[model samples]
Target: MPIGPQPHGRRGTVEEPYTPLNLRLVLAAFGLVVCVGLSILLFRMGWTVPGWLLAGWAVVALVDIVVIQFRRRARARAEGGDHSLFE
Candidate 1:
């Protein structure tokens, strides 16, 4: 089906802009990079309390981001496309 461009204005009661799936993907990528960079920095600082904490944070962040991204993509596919951010 041919989908047309969606208007980029607030449509709901809450004031906000429409964030497309592609833009979300880009943000997710940046988040992942930040997680990785932090993890590397922690590891480079040698094994310590803060290092362990950062490592745990990195794991949680990576998992959360990956799961969210996959769910979004899957939901988009299951429906018709990325027309709705609702999952």
Candidate 2:
């Protein structure tokens, strides 16, 4: 049996709320810190390959943080509010 309401010719659409950007930014920042720290530890322990891999992931996390900051700033500007890093 079909669950819930059918498509019904696409007359009605449901919209889902999105995760807040600040939360995403915080998570990305945390990931970057952890990756960098672990990669450094791995390098000190002579695990070069894994260290490099973690370093690469750290870079990705840094990039995500930058993008999220930009988006957050834009959103704040659109909403006519002053946006700060700690906000």
TM-score for all models, in order of appearance: 0.48, 0.73
Clash count list over all predictions: 0, 0
Global lDDT of model 1: 0.57
The CA lDDT at 51 in model 1 is: 65
Q: Which stretches of candidate 1 lie over 4 Å from their true place?
A: 1-29, 83-87
What candidate 2 gets wrong by more than 4 Å, as runs, is: 1-17, 82-87
Residue-level lDDT for 63 in candidate 1 = 74
Error of 1 at 46 (Å): 3.3
**Candidate 2 lDDT tens digits, 6-81:** 2323433355333366778888999999999999999999999999999999999999887777766666555656
Q: What is the lDDT of residue 58 in candidate 2?
A: 100
Most accurate candidate by TM-score: 2
Superpose all Cα atoms of candidate 1 onto the true structure and report the RMSD in Å to 1 decimal.
7.6
